[model samples]
Target: MCVHGSNNNPDIGQLLEGLPTNWGKWGPDDEVGALNYLQAEQVLRGIAAVRQGRTFTLQIPIGHEKGEPLFPGRRPSMRMNVLDKGHYLAGKAHFDGNVEFSDDVIFMHVQGSTQYDALGHVWYDDKLWNGYDAMSTIGSMARASIVPIAERGVAGRAVLVDMARHRGKAVLDKGETFTHHDLLAAARAQGTAIEPRDILIIRTGWIGSFYEREAAEFYSDFVEPGLTFSRELVEWFHAMEIPNLVTDTMGNEVTVDPRSGVMIPLHAALMRNLGVAFAEVAQLDALAEDCARDGQWQFLYTAAPLKIVGGTGAPVNPLVIK
Candidate 1:
């Protein structure tokens, strides 16, 4: 079966109904969906949270040099170094006293590592964000490209809802999931409030497991512990007007949906339909540690995807400052 094709599940259409959506809410030419909520005031709020000069790099290094990517289709990046070998270094000297250095040529899958999914990354039916035809819209550089995200960058107050810490466990076991209530409870426990335009980062302890076990073992079975996808949770995010989100899981949502014949349903709903970007595979363990130690979960979060024009996604090195 084609992964991108519409599901045969009869209730799919009904499931989408009544959920909040921002289609045309900004304008007919709206490219970034809920991201428009992160305005000057929101940025200022994030900046004000930086009480300490400490910074946390939220990205997993690109490619297998660090660790293997869990996604099968996404390959690790390749790098080729070109060393300095000029005529001045040889017997046939040309320059008087100049020397050269080395550079590298890198080939990478944009979403292969810690990365942001562009607004044009996913779609349902024949449509994309703001009801544009998927084929024509994604075929060109007209709308929903990564360039806009790169140019603007994401700067806002980020709230880390550590699910593992809330449940008093190292990680949620396979097949375990958390609900919207659990998220709120976790935020409350952390003394952080989910606010409008806030960048939400949900920690599932999946990355912690990756660190504890063999890289191959962690990447072996693709199971992931993540938020339970429901109308309530998705709609709550909409009502909250969250601009963007990050998660340590391979996919922001659960690795596999409990419902049969559906995969990453929230990905389609949020990115394709809602026009929200997602930064996945974030290195959140250190940030979570620091938050728990300091009793502060709010921080200045910034992420900028590579400026690959008309790309579907690009690797990102997000930062959290406190």
Candidate 2:
């Protein structure tokens, strides 16, 4: 009989009973709810293993897409200036000049390029993550405006799912959207199975075209080449309870929905709804090649964003150590 309860739904019990006899069983008293005694024991064991410091880190660099200039119908260009003040020896004495440093310049604003977007960076309708209003949450501060991501330093076993190798191509089409099935297929192709709490690093091979100014052109209204995660994919990540999702692309998702002409929905679903921090604009071309040759997807990930207080996002230099 199927018993329905809001707090303790007995329907779960009936569902478990329908499983094959060889399947494990759990009692209400001996076991904690649906998790059987053996399953719970395994969970505790896994927790202990994680506490023992068995993990790797991958560093992903934020590309030069953000520093590019935006001119109508002009190819994007990067403009960075360095100011150095030194001493000149004059009359057997060193004379120091006035110190000055400036990188104050305007260029094309690549919203997702090498950026860790604050919770206020994007909002769903009117509500930001954790029910914080976008406008209210963002102000003069840059880094601290969002949650303390860098403070904790996301650490975990990173799995690089190389989609480019699976497709035998360098870049996925600008408007292509990646579904849950596509991700699974890519993983299977690489012979790497994604586990729970694993930092999923997706390499779409888009960073190669980043330096190709002509091919990687930015349109005022049109979409660009990148992978868009489907709704199912977001749910899968949540169910798996992964620590974070890192990708090598501008937005980590296709810019436009091929059918609906809308922008990335996965960003909202993953970052806002699931509280999943996304590491975007990752430079993964070289890392992908190494992983493909070595047949290993693990890497030590390290990324430290500028400590810009009360800011929306900060420039980051993420690196990967094998």
Candidate 3:
């Protein structure tokens, strides 16, 4: 694997010092992390926010003929044919009945497409969310896996903060950064309020650009533009009780921290320390345009990932009902 950070990278522990943690806030055996905030009441809140009957699916299509927007080191999902008319014609396959069937298999990183990351996806100090031992992820994720999230599901009111539109840009420049303050500013500009415990869906237009440009240009020096880590930003998440963060980027936060030169510091500060769930690589162009035209930014955000046992993450098509 192409590990991006260096031996000289600042210690993640020191990088996240002075930030609070939600490790045991739920319970000793807590495994879903911040998804615990998404209770029945949150679902009711989501239903109430549905001002229109319109719906939008936020997942990018997997196995596009051109390519997929993936984390730098990860390959695209590969679809292999199992059986088809061609196989029967070649006399290489047969069915029990007087019929021919087709089957196929896929090889992919659970996180290769738009997906929800496990709370234990990244860790430090030899621990995962809720103080689970990092060793539990040795063979397959035993604790804090995506199973809990997929089984529980995520349903809540969501606000899409379109940073690209707010900045008057079609797409934010590579390696660009934003903070919670920027989120609030953009929400204000959009005339929307970010309520407590709302599913936060942010759009930088990074993932959407994959279709418009060549893969070489898209992945060159690929540092995704997104949320930047800070003590204040982490504190804002804690105070707001933001349950799930959805975004149009591989890593929710900027790929590298400018202040610390650490790769994805928010993966530790927010996902690990604050227990915030991450849903990354969403396609939000359609949703953003709709919200922009209608001036209604809040919606009922609901997603259920494939319930794969021992999966670190699972593909999902998040639906925004407005």
Residue-by-residue lDDT tens digits, candidate 3, 261-316: 89889999889988899999999999999999999999899999999888889999
Order of candidate numbers by lDDT, starting with the best: 3, 1, 2
TM-score leader = 3
Q: 1-322, model 1: which lDDT tens digit per residue?
A: 1233235753444657667778889898877777788898998999998888799998876544455455655566887765446433664444446755556688777787788887877766777778777775546556777777888789888889999888888777755678779888889988888887788899988865765777676656566778767887787888788889798887888766676436677887677667777889887889999999998899899888889888877888998998
Between candidates 1 and 2, the one scoring higher on TM-score is 1
lDDT of 2 by residue, 58-88 (tens): 3332235443322124344345443223212
lDDT of each: 0.77, 0.53, 0.91
Summing lDDT over every window of 10 consecutive residues in candidate 3, give the lowest-scoring window. 1-10
Could you tell me which 10 consecutive residues in candidate 2 have the lowest summed lDDT? 28-37
Candidate with maximal lDDT = 3
Candidate 2's C-alpha runs over 4 A off are 1-113, 141-144, 213-222
- Candidate 3 regions with alpha-carbon error over 4 angstroms: 6-8, 94-97
lDDT score for residue 25 of model 1:
90
